[model samples]
Target: MSQEEKKSRNGGRREAEPERREKKPSRRRRRAGISGVLLYVLFIIGVSAFLAGVGWVAANDVLALNKPEHTAIITIADGEKFGNVIDDLKENGIIEHKSFFWIFSVMTKSKDKIAAGTYELNTDMDYRAIITNLGSHSASRQEVTVTITEGMTVAQIFQLLEKSGVSTVEKLNDTAANHDYKFSFLENIPLGKATRLEGYLFPDTYKFYMGQDPLYVINKMLVTFDAKLTEEMRQQILDSDRTIAEIVTVASLIEKETDGTDQGKIASVIYNRLDHPNAETAGFLNIDATIYYVTGKTVTQADYQGVESPYNTYLYKGLPPGPIANPGMVAIRAAMNPDSTGYYYYAMNSKTGLHEYSKTYAEHQQKLASFGD
Candidate 1:
């Protein structure tokens, strides 16, 4: 190598020598000695400086997003991506730090595990709660449920209402029985002198608001029912030229026969027999439901044939004067939509709960006897 190159290499080596010398602490005593006390003093100053710097950075890094003027629910859906969730939290002022959320999600490996749904995120949430809600799935809905069991009379329903703190059952019954009430669906029989509506109370678990009035509760049920019974059903009745009330009356019969299965077929047979139009001058439907209503006690076929009422299809019938009980959509639909068949008589099989369908009356009579009547 040339002299310049040699000198440059020597200079590089010389520069590295000082770094090596500086790397180790000085072991050789100076003319003046450096004591251990001085070293501890330096360490204390350095630590204090470092702590002060950290406190300053943390203080400067802080920022608070203003809260909502009026609190509102913010839903973070299930299986939602972390990036979008951060945006939602920020947008709703539930959170201010994107970095903190991002770091938490990454460190916890929670990217794919975040639940799906409408989460109840509020401004009052702490940072941990905010993260927790985002990571889970549950909808925010206000629903209060009340149950109406099968075969409950309007009076019973009223009692249930009072028990639930909606209103006194007495008041509800009075309202239902009241002729002057605005809800005219009750108290107006199309062709009969029936005292009350028993066969029209649809059974199910009903949902209502906590403080809702009786009228609102009743109206919601009625509206839901009207929607369920399609317009086509109404049209079919109109085409058959049967009054709306008559269809309801038959629907009550089917509803009564149904606590067992084969409900649809048995219901169809009743319509078929009725279609003959006074062939028996009202052969009794002799349905178990009608007897159960009057006596408030369950009856079998043998105990059944003896009772009589205008509502009793067995005693006299074209159709009852009005609905015997509140029939649900299932029974009402059966009445409106009967199966076209040669089935003139049908009876429920007590053992299997299946209907034994027959075209002739004699076969049904034999089956009825076998029913342990």
Candidate 2:
């Protein structure tokens, strides 16, 4: 009876052990499958991150690479936004990828640091280099010195500006006629006229940058004029029963009439003719320079009497529509404070480079004969 019971128990235990071992293998298989799946997911994640890193590095290299050979000029106007500047870079071929440049700029917090100015850039400059350059003002400036002489016409002034490489004649003229300047003297200038600023460009030595905006160059000249025409002088001009325009016109006439040595005397002659006792009969200025100004030629008898432009002082009595040329501080002073000379006529003395004055027509003729005019 003991042997039969022991054999049955052993048989049951063996069967139970086999079932438990089978259960263990199934659990291990399940665990191994889960682990393999987890490892595969981690490997995929690592590969994706590596690809992103490689793309980022490539983008960074492209942004920092320069490919152009020659230099280019980029102008960022005042109040221009960073987005607009990025567009300009794209349009100018300075950057190939505007979206990337914008993104990098934003990430680096450099969008707000850009400055407004004329930049000397090149295709050889990378996006980062261009950004850094635009942030600095003096980095791209090319300064130039220009000396504008007194009694220069608007055309002449522009010619000088063009010659100095400070601006183009077309640009200067356009700016002079259209741009709104910040000055008291410009208040009376007719903005629509082509030659509105003809007489107001003060003749002086000026230092400017090459490739500068034409409006900025014009403003610099106007500021010089404002600075040169002192407060006291302006007050004097106001005290005189003449407008600033009228004074400038008269000064321009005096500047063109004779050399600076006899400016006061010539100014007196102009005033005498304008305010003569018999103004209706003898008020004509009859300035040959005015005729030349109208005809754009040296004064000839045909040109003098043929032209009917308002600038012809021989035809009209008062000052022209505006100044015919730019006048210096000296000429302006002479026009404002003329000598109390009774003479009403003047002619150049070719022998001495001085002028001969006369109170009568006969005396003027005699002096002209003596000067061999």
Candidate 3:
């Protein structure tokens, strides 16, 4: 009786264990499948929402108003209508949709608050650029450059300054003639002759913003020149037994007469000419710079025949009224201490940047003739 009862109970327990394990596995599989289906539905809904937004933005500009870039600083000029302003932004590629910008403008209630003036507008402008630029000013600053060569005349310098947004050279020319510069060299200038400070203004590159004052340019150049021409240099000029004007005058002539190496010696010859009356005929500076000064043009055969100013050494004697052009440091140093040389006649070959120096006129002429090859 006990064996039979034990066998029946064991069989029932075995069947129940198998059924419980199987049911547990089936429940787990069903739960996982339901979770997977829910996740796929959510993914499809997210994709559809994204595509709908893209289409809406493409069709209507109003959605563009909500874009973050709309608040950027985009300036709109005065008296322009909202539509025209929007069109300008669109043309500049700042706004992708016109309707978006209008909606933004209306939502922000800035339609009438917009001011007129120069503006800075860029591509990322969404609603920010429209409203930000609508406020006055935000214009991009422009780049400016000014250049003056080493030997430009005051007139030339003035023209350059004006062109670079400095005051016009004509105004400065008038001021110079009226003794407004007030420098001693300028003070004694004859009524009809040009004004002072022709050579005193140093030449170099300069930069300034648009609408720079004419006086600012003049002061900057003069300050630079004075600073470069230290007290020690001025004393050296006085020691040479020449006034500042005479030193610069001779230096200018030496600059134009000889080619490269002979500048110092050529300067010495000019000093010698001043010392010895016959040196004019012997070494005879016969300088072309004097002609350039008088005629305000380089030498040509016809100018010699035309009426001449006192600056012309061919027709007149001594240095001209002022320096013909701004002289570099080389010419200034040459005038201070000229080279020791007996050679007097000097000529530069037109084709080459070379010079021929001769002790006698015949030798100089021979060198000039030989220069043809």
Winner by TM-score: 2
In candidate 2, stretches whose alpha carbon ends up further than 4 angstroms from where it belongs are: 1-135, 277-281
* Residues 203-308, model 2: lDDT tens digits: 8887778877776677667756876888898889889988888888989998888777888998998888888749433778888888877778887666566788
- Give the TM-score of each candidate: 0.53, 0.63, 0.56
lDDT of 1 by residue, 36-105 (tens): 6678789999999999976554333222234432222344554556788778766755565667667766
lDDT of 2 at 336: 94
Q: Judge candidate 2 at residue 191 and give its lDDT.
A: 81
Q: Model 1: which ten-residue window has the lowest total lDDT?
A: 63-72
Q: What is the C-alpha RMSD of each candidate to the true structure, in Å?
A: 20.5, 16.1, 18.8
Model 1 CA deviation exceeding 4 Å by range:
1-143, 149-152, 179-196, 209-212, 259-261, 277-282, 299-308, 369-373
What ranking emerges by TM-score with the best candidate at the front? 2, 3, 1
Whole-structure CA lDDT of model 2: 0.79
Q: TM-score of predicted model 3? A: 0.56
Off by over 4 Å in 3: 1-143, 182-194, 258-261, 280-284, 301-306
Measured by lDDT, the strongest candidate is: 2
